[model samples]
Target: SQQGEEDPQALSIQEGENATMNCSYKTSINNLQWYRQNSGRGLVHLILIRSNEREKHSGRLRVTLDTSKKSSSLLITASRAADTASYFCATDGLNYNQGGKLIFGQGTELSVKP
Candidate 1:
């Protein structure tokens, strides 16, 4: 499986602090997307950075993609209790062998303490 795997497995931080998570994949990818899932809820798309792009930002969320390293990182600034969730990185491989499927990481469970 070329699915990405998130590092640290879990994270714990206080409200107003910053949270960072890393994802590493096995194969080439065309684009990578970050998604957040609250307990027992569906995943919500956060940001997407193409393979050609190095960095992107949306509000307080920052994403960096390093294709050369087959890795990506997600940074959430000024974290809040509401931001507590499992963060997953999904990637669409450069080749369409998977029929345009997005391989997802195991996810990093984040906890924000108020």
Candidate 2:
């Protein structure tokens, strides 16, 4: 069974706007990560918030975790047409012995219209 599931499923915004996506998961996790994929290609790691960490940021991207709610959110500021892609949240599952394995959510497709 999938451990994580993305909410909304899709998002659309114009350049300079902010894009937000969310994810919810079941079971305890060592960490939660956000990733982006362009043109159906491989995913690019964005940011990760450890189970003990509440938030993290990278460049124009921000990630927040609320373990109490088993949920996480990703915010992308200054949206660009290039940012149009599929955003997914992933979890490492309940442990670390999994050898860096990741279980991904259904993904939220974001379109940054020019």
List, residue by residue over 19-97, the lDDT tens digit for candidate 1: 9999999888899999999999999999999999999999999999998999999999999999989999999888867
lDDT of 2 at 56: 89
lDDT of 2 by residue, 1-114 (tens): 888889889998899999989999988888999988998599998888999999888999989999999999999999999999999999987665889899899999999999
TM-score of 1: 0.95
**Cα displacement (Å) at residue 59, model 1:** 0.3
**C-alpha TM-score for every candidate:** 0.95, 0.95
Candidate 1 ranges with C-alpha deviation above 4 Å: none
Clashes of each: 0, 0
The C-alpha lDDT values of all candidates are 0.94, 0.91
Q: What's the C-alpha lDDT at position 39 in model 2?
A: 80
